[model samples]
Target: MLMKANEPVGSGQTGLSDSEAASLYRLMTWLSPSFPVGAFSYSSGIEWAVEAGDIVDATSLRHWLASMLADGAGLCDGIFLAQTHRAASSGDDVLLAEVAELASAFATSRERHLETTAQGRAFIEIARAAWNSPPLDRLIAVCEVAIVYPVAVGLVSAAHATPLAPTVHAFLHAVVSNWISAGARLVPLGQTDSQRLLVELEPVVSATATRALKASLDDLGSATFRADLASMRHEAQYTRLFRS
Candidate 1:
């Protein structure tokens, strides 16, 4: 039988409720690298950074990504996702539309735009097919333009009744992990280093998500100019493995 959203899925007292467990599962699946969003195909300009010698090792990689999460696309995208989730959950189509428009225009470079929107379009297509809901339908109808990656994720998470906090954290975690993966391959780091980077980023991911939840649309901004330039430079890069 289909479990109601409020019903418990497991018997243990320490276990998550049905809705919580379902939300967790969905978030994990959606944010997983195996998801069909093609996230692994884009390095978010990490490739260019590596090539430019901005990231020569795991330590450098962590520093670069730390700035990104705190002052760049990572934080900006988090705010966008948080706003999108709030707008979506509140049934505020006008606000949702505004957020979506701003997010689409917020891309710093051509390849960056392509990177986000491509994954976004793919995310929405796959999600609608697999997890269709009325809210998702309304979100699509309201936002006529190309949805950005964060907006797509926020909208889908809200549609599924997933809480914003975990959704934001998971989304950011996936982004950080993807960047680390790119760094690992480019820098030729071992499995241990990559895993270590992820572990070290746990606090950063938490702090970012916390700030995102409290942030308003006015908080949307990025200070990571080098990272932005890397994305632009990636376009003309002679040898490239990533789309951005």
Candidate 2:
């Protein structure tokens, strides 16, 4: 249960007590690692950091995760998540396209593109086919390349019937988990170390969740310089395991 820096957990008192809570629990369960968002395959920036020797072990992995949380995923993902929700609710193809383009252009590695975009595209389709959501389906049709991560997240949120904050929180949690998983595999960290990192990151995730509420596109920026460079470099790498 990683908590963003300042995010408050759901009150557990939405008055729906039994059935509603059960449904939400089910939704969260499905959206976890087993959800077909293709999340497990990508290291985001972790793959690149490991390749460049910047992240060689547990300590370095923690350092990289902290920097990424502060610089990129914390803000960029939140902003994109908001955009997806907006486009889906409004049924605006133009806006969705704009978001997709913006996100696609941000990718520096082929793996990054495939990792994020592939999921984004499939996500739109899943929402359309499974939920029969007209707005989301249409949004998918227009998004061919990497769908923006946030936008895909928003669509998933809508499909799950979870509100904005929970949806966003779930996303942040997934990122922390994914990065930890990547670190565990790439840096050969023990399961205990990975879990510890997740626990340590709870406050950061909680804090970021709250700060994310006030963030917009203008505030989206990344300070992980080497990570970004490694992603660019991975596109041409002769061999690699994880996507960017």
Best by TM-score: 1
Tens digits of per-residue lDDT for model 1, 1-244: 6779998656565578779889999999999999999988999899999999999999999999999999999999999999999999999999999999999999999999999999999999999999888779988889988999999999999999999999999999999999999889899799999999999999998999899999998888899999999999999999999899
Clashes of each: 0, 17
lDDT of 2 by residue, 1-244 (tens): 7779787556563566564675467457545787677777777767767777999988788877777776765557766776666666667768777776776776655666677777666655655566564545555677666566666777666545556776667778887898899779887889899989998888887777766766766777788777777767776666677766
Q: Which ranges in model 1 have alpha carbons more than 4 Å from their true place?
A: 1-12
Instruction: Give each model's whole-structure lDDT.
Output: 0.93, 0.71
State in Å the error of residue 213, model 1. 0.6
lDDT of 1: 0.93
Q: Give TM per candidate.
A: 0.94, 0.80
Q: How close is candidate 1 to the true structure, as a TM-score?
A: 0.94
